[model samples]
Target: MFNRKHLEAILITRTELRLPRTTPEAVGIRSTAIAALLDAWKESGLELHSMMILRHGQVAAEGWWAPYAPELSHMLFSLSKSFTSSAIGLAAAEGLLSLDDAVISFFPEVAPEEPSANLSAMRVRHLLMMGTGHEEDTMGPLSSAEDGDWVRAFLQVPVGREPGTHFVYNSGATYMLSAILQKVSGVKLLDYLRPRLLDPLGITEGTWESCPRGIHTGGWGLMLTTESIAKFGQLYLQRGVWEGKRILSEEWVNEATSKQIHNGDDEANDWTQGYGYQFWRCRNGAYRGDGAFGQFCIVLPEKDTVIALTSGTNDMQGVLNGIWTHLLPALTEDVTADPAAHEALSDKLGSLTLEPPVLDAASPLESEVSGSRYVLDENQFQWTALSVQFESQEAVVTLENCEGEFVLRCGRGEWAEGRGVLLQGAPFQRGANHRMASSFTWRDSETLSITLRYIETPFYVTSELKFNGDELTAQQQVNVAFFSPELPSLHGRRS
Candidate 1:
């Protein structure tokens, strides 16, 4: 049986034993330089979740913000495309498929009765390089198909230009690549790559979201540990060789990482440099596989380094900028051992955490509304009632929504961990038993503010409950979302 937990699983180990840990000086970089990079990232106010810097196949420096530990799997969004590309490379090596094979040939049943010239010319290589000729992304239509036939829906999308002559970041194209791989291999993408790729790297745990047809969503929704991401980057940096054995052909790695098409003209922007097979070319002759909202596996071949990072921020460019500004310089220069700097860097990395809600005194309204259930007006969320109870140092809130009752224990200016229904809707799975951390603070005399962090994913929710006499007004918003971040407000009266 297919388990939903495996698709969005969270591991609970505390130690990172998969990779060798070492001092920054052993990797040709000063410990202070890494500390400085951390300082710069903190100053920029990016919501970084985890970071792992590796050089010479050794973990030089690594850290995870509180609640976002090394054991937990972080969502990789579009970064999964690179893994799908790897599967394609492996399949090609086994003669299961070819780069030049016509994509339409894989699914003749789903193909349009009369395929266009552009669509017929589309090849597996075009999908790998994001050179599909569609004028825009086909995801919108592909996702909204009533029958859930994504392959057929994708094939029907008109190709606006010649496949090899135009470049469009089409995720549906990636999905087609996944469907083709499954068609040729007779198994799921993850299972097919497990023994050949993931197992060789000691990555035994992972999950990929599947489509309605049980195919993995090739372009997004992959979850893996920070260390697992580093291992992947390290493998690519070493030309697909792991432990003196070649897991992937050097020919495939070279062709995949080399710039296959020009993307833009901006010399300063990283996205414009060029594009390879499921990889983005970087400014300093490096390449990377990056996802939306800042999940990155950056490989710097010239410097022999790989940096894995996971974060939640609107400014993806800001992250790469910080890396270029501080971390890039340290990679090239030689530095002597400084025990004091190494100790300082270690301490800083050890203590890294995202600040919780601000500490504030309890509002007098807490006593009046304590244990009182508020009967809420009908809203889109279908929340019918809400109740709050205060204790010695924590606040427990009970909410009744469409999914039934959800109880959250929030610490006062600190995080309280628990497993319960994830109240944030849409992109997040709506069910119980999701790992989360929460903190609450009194914003004013009558307002109670709370922060909910879904630790396994790059998302958090901020809610405010305001009380006036017998009336209650509740407002909630997510930090980032595929849907609208501004959720509907609820008005209610004490019951």
Candidate 2:
């Protein structure tokens, strides 16, 4: 049934029905409203990478910050959960599985000995709703176990309360959903959706990171371009029908997006509004699939619009707040044409860029530190040796660590792109293809500072190297960290 000819046919149909492009005024949205949203984002200190606004199934505005282009597939983090949930929906439609099925039924071999009553009552729907009954998140312990058998480890965890009685933001539960889908379908989550969802949607460049056992990481690690995310939202907005064909059953879409449980009592908090199957309901009668660091796919049925964005900011709520304040009120029922506003908004979107690090004249200290090897005492980073070489416009820094010799070329003021692996420290490890944009500046006559930004991820590291006569000290700090608020500084001395 999964043949090349069928996949090609689906792709052709998707291209024929590709989302139309139009001016904001052609839709009911005012161009000035989008401009105001951008202004609000900047004022909120949010670092935006890319965004696309759609109205009436047509793209009204889309742009990417310089260095982060529209073609690049950004890491979606937990936004991947929405796609995984879709895969389960497809499997159910095919009669391969049912939402009421006991999760343990799919993995008899991994089932715990004498499963607890709570575990026994756990259903697939419970996993979908984050109602696993575990008081706290189980991903930490389940992922850290040495055996690397995530299924077995998760099953062994004590289900403290009856299934569906409570809600905990459990990523492991989503992972279990992926594992169950794979168990029944005999394929990974991504593969299962390739022909059924992605091909039909014309998303050709989707990828998902796999665990040690080669299973797709359902709760995280999916990558897609901004337009692809917008397409997914548009599909859900159309009630699972793309063009004339029904890609997903309308019944499934309604159930998946409807609030399944009460997540919190605070009505003021957006996250407390409600939660569906891997979808978060908003106060304005909308829902979204979002990830860490502000990756969002918002579906606004009331406005006949969808907004997709990828960002590297800690204040995710701030992004949503900007949307509600700036974009929500602008969605009118009738198109309002303002050529001046459209031109201004177009110019601003075309010129969007992240500010580069400041550059200053080379210091006299450069002559003293040029090609100097710094030998260090024991430090938290375990960096053994370091060297710096000054060039006309950039500095080349080399360091020896447990992983081996690593080199980074830092631009004087601009962002210089380089590929390498950033060691695991703050939260998680990245792939070798990870790209970092680096900049260097002389903080003073005696101090040199360098900033390395993993553009694909949210965090950035700032290193300060201070020189006092022949002695040198190095300190590293993270702008925002996941596991810890503050990281220990590494100390070193020049030999």
Candidate 3:
């Protein structure tokens, strides 16, 4: 359980060493370069939600797209691994456990009756470095276990090679680390880190999703604001010291950020540089904690800078490339203010909006089919029927599935906010009530396209409804899908 008094103290620290705001030009950076980066990202079709650039312990530039604000806690996905690693570091510093300790020792009861030689040899360090001997990721098998005993199921999987000799990206390994922390600390990972980390850095509003067993999902499902992420990166930049107090030991920081495994060798890309404990080495002599679809906490040691961003984009690498290409070159040794360029950049940032899909003139078929219900053919989504009703400025789509009716409101050429589900009982939705923004456009005389964006998450669904007399065919696609982008097509007859 979290203490309210401790939380209040943490909130008070928000003012102690709050990052001061300044223009990019004042921090020896060219504002035009930041603009160029934004333009490049927009051109490449990357949907950026928010960004914050910090230099010399001050924020140089910050912006959030309209729907994404500064206060909202955006999901950090795998970036949560870095924070989990921090918890382990804190625990190790307190002498609660050692990195060399055999993982089986923590959960003796859950250990196999006769543990395999490779499994018995596995250590906490192997899990940190993603070197847990398993040739393939274990998350799938662990998740599939009927009993949901994740720890036991993880141990049951054969460790094909000796621990610390192989690297396979495994979220299950990180989950084990979280389980170990909970076992040793006698509390959840978040509670353990509250006083040691979040409070000290003034990061009061953050949440980590938990597994069915109540352990924090260590590899993913962390949520924080962009500033919180920047603060985290800045802590690493200052060698784990925050507000002149050492929160994490310098020794732990060194080990955590240093290359623990050789992941890839492609010199052109940041991800190919190498892998730290939970960080990825970048080409421009930096390291970062990143999540799928571009949640980044980048630390540039050589440049004395930290950057944080949250985005819903497929080209995560492109965001990094833009930073390296545009922002890196702009950092200079001496501070030189370019007021005009700064003003222009600020203006551009303030005006940023994700352009909604454009809608053509109302379809000639609108009047005939506007209020008609269509009975849909059997589909994987289990949607039984759908109907479209167009008003003067917006359209309403009502869909019925196994979960019941969902009325999605869509603007003609804008985003209209509503409460609805893209697909009810979707595994990716995680049972959370959806707050969505939807828009619709006519692709042609017979085709109507709709985009539904889950405002709180990094995914969206696009559906195309084609009309041919009394017959309709609907196709759905997701922007960033977990398994497959393709959704089942629904053939329907007007009723």
TM-score of each: 0.95, 0.93, 0.92
Candidate numbers sorted by lDDT from highest down: 1, 3, 2
- Candidate 1 similarity to native, TM-score: 0.95
Error of 1 at 449 (Å): 0.6
Best by TM-score: 1
| Cα error of candidate 2 at position 404, Å | 4.1
Q: For residues 1-495, could you state the per-residue lDDT of candidate 3 as single tens digits?
A: 112232122233436546788888778888989999999998888899889999988999888775556656777889999999999999999999999999999989989989989999999999999999999989988889788788888998999999988778899999999999999999999999899999888888887888778888899988887889999999999999987899999999989999898787788878777787888888878999999889999999999999999998888989998999899998886757788889999988776666568868478888888989999988877879999999888999998887788788888888787766447433254555656778889999899999887756677788999999899998888887566787778899998
lDDT of each: 0.87, 0.85, 0.85
Sort all candidates by TM-score, best to worst: 1, 2, 3
Per-residue lDDT of 485 in model 2: 43
Off by over 4 Å in 2: 1-19, 359-361, 378-382, 402-404
Residue-wise C-alpha lDDT for candidate 1, range 315-381, written one tens digit per residue: 8888999989888888855678889999999888877788787957587778888999999998877
Model 2, range 114-231, lDDT digits (tens) per residue?
8999999999999999999998888887779798888888898899999898889999999998999898999999999999999888888888877778889799989888888999
Clash pairs for candidate 3: none
Model 3 C-alpha RMSD vs. true structure (Å) is: 5.0
**Local error of candidate 3 at residue 334 (angstroms):** 1.7
Runs off by more than 4 Å, candidate 1: 1-17, 424-426, 431-433
